[model samples]
Target chain A: EAGVTQSPTHLIKTRGQQATLRCSPISGHTSVYWYQQALGLGLQFLLWYDEGEERNRGNFPPRFSGRQFPNYSSELNVNALELEDSALYLCASSRRGNLNYGYTFGSGTRLTVV
Target chain B: QKEVEQDPGPLSVPEGAIVSLNCTYSNSAFQYFMWYRQYSRKGPELLMYTYSSGNKEDGRFTAQVDKSSKYISLFIRDSQPSDSATYLCAMNGVGYGQNFVFGPGTRLSVLP
Candidate 1:
């Protein structure tokens, strides 16, 4: 089966600008999650979406937001970006009602903020 | 203290050697444990998962969980150069809406 897919493998943006990352879940998955991996800082959860609704989010600021579509795909938006926002943004998907099975992750989008 | 603690080792070992990695968590509520391997600049792939305190083996990898001590371990036998990567331990409570907590990864390198 094809795995989760993320778009724009690499992105470059400047501080104060806005950036958007996209993710398409596996064919039958219904839950999508976003995570940020920065140098020195390990993987940090960003947001969780299930059946097109935002279920939960991490400690990140409001500027970091995202939405899931009807097809179970997701998009992450980071507004007023800062240098510290530069990191590898990973997207994962899992079947609803089965959290025991770990998520399947995409390679991730590398965002570089200058 | 953080929910999970792990040694961020840049451990180097020769091929065919045994490798051991571990993580300790403070939250007793966490019931599901997992080990993920991530190559540089790549996403993490699940290596082993256990629902409760016990041990599970897959090929050359073995995962052990000890709920009493809130500790977990991953052992790789006869390691290969292809096993070089960062290993991360994750866990979460059994309740709904509970999210997975991941440890700062430990980097491992196996030499030929």
Candidate 2:
């Protein structure tokens, strides 16, 4: 099994610019989730997508948005990025309608806003 | 108050010592509890998962969940240096697309 995979392991972006992070879920997984892990803040939920639909989102602002493709891959986009957006963005995946097994997480994209 | 609470300890222990990590959650609706081990720069890997209450054992690791007390625990026996990492506790309810609440994580270091 390939597990979850994320692209652009490290990214640096200027303040006020936009950033895009990508994720590919494991084979046979249909649900994708995005989270932000800031220093000492733990994991903050960002968004959740299932079967190509945005199921729910966290308390994040509208600037933090993302979409899941038909293939179950996901892309997180941050517009008007602030220095606070520089935390590591993680993606996780799980089988459809399954929560007992827990989600499989990717290594995450380290986004640095300068 | 946060949904889940854990002591953010950078606990140091001997290589062969027994390690105990714990988390307390404010939400009694959370039925599934889990433990994840994460390296400094890597993503978290699920170590154990337990439903409702009771204990589950896997080799050198054990996960205990007490729904009545809203507390959960992870025990590592004969800890090795390779076990040095941050341990995270998470839980969620029966919803299909619900987000699993996570703790701040406890950093563990097994000294050789």
Largest lDDT belongs to which candidate?
A: 2
Total colliding residue pairs, candidate 1: 0
Model 2 local distance difference test score: 0.94
Candidate 2 lDDT tens digits, A1-114: 898999999999999999999999999999999999999999999999999999999999999998999888999999999999989899999987787678899999999999
Docking class of 2: high
Instruction: Please name the candidate that would achieve the greatest DockQ relative to the true structure.
Output: 2
Docking class of 1: medium
lDDT of 1 by residue, B44-110 (tens): 9989989989999999999999999999999999999999999999898855264788999899999
Query: Interface RMSD for every prediction, one decimal?
Result: 1.2, 0.7
> Mind giving the per-residue lDDT tens digits that candidate 2 earns over B2-95?
9999989999999999999999998888898999999989999999999999999999999999999999999999999999999999998855
The C-alpha stretches of model 1 lying farther than 4 A from their native spots are B95-98
How accurate locally, in lDDT, is each candidate? 0.93, 0.94
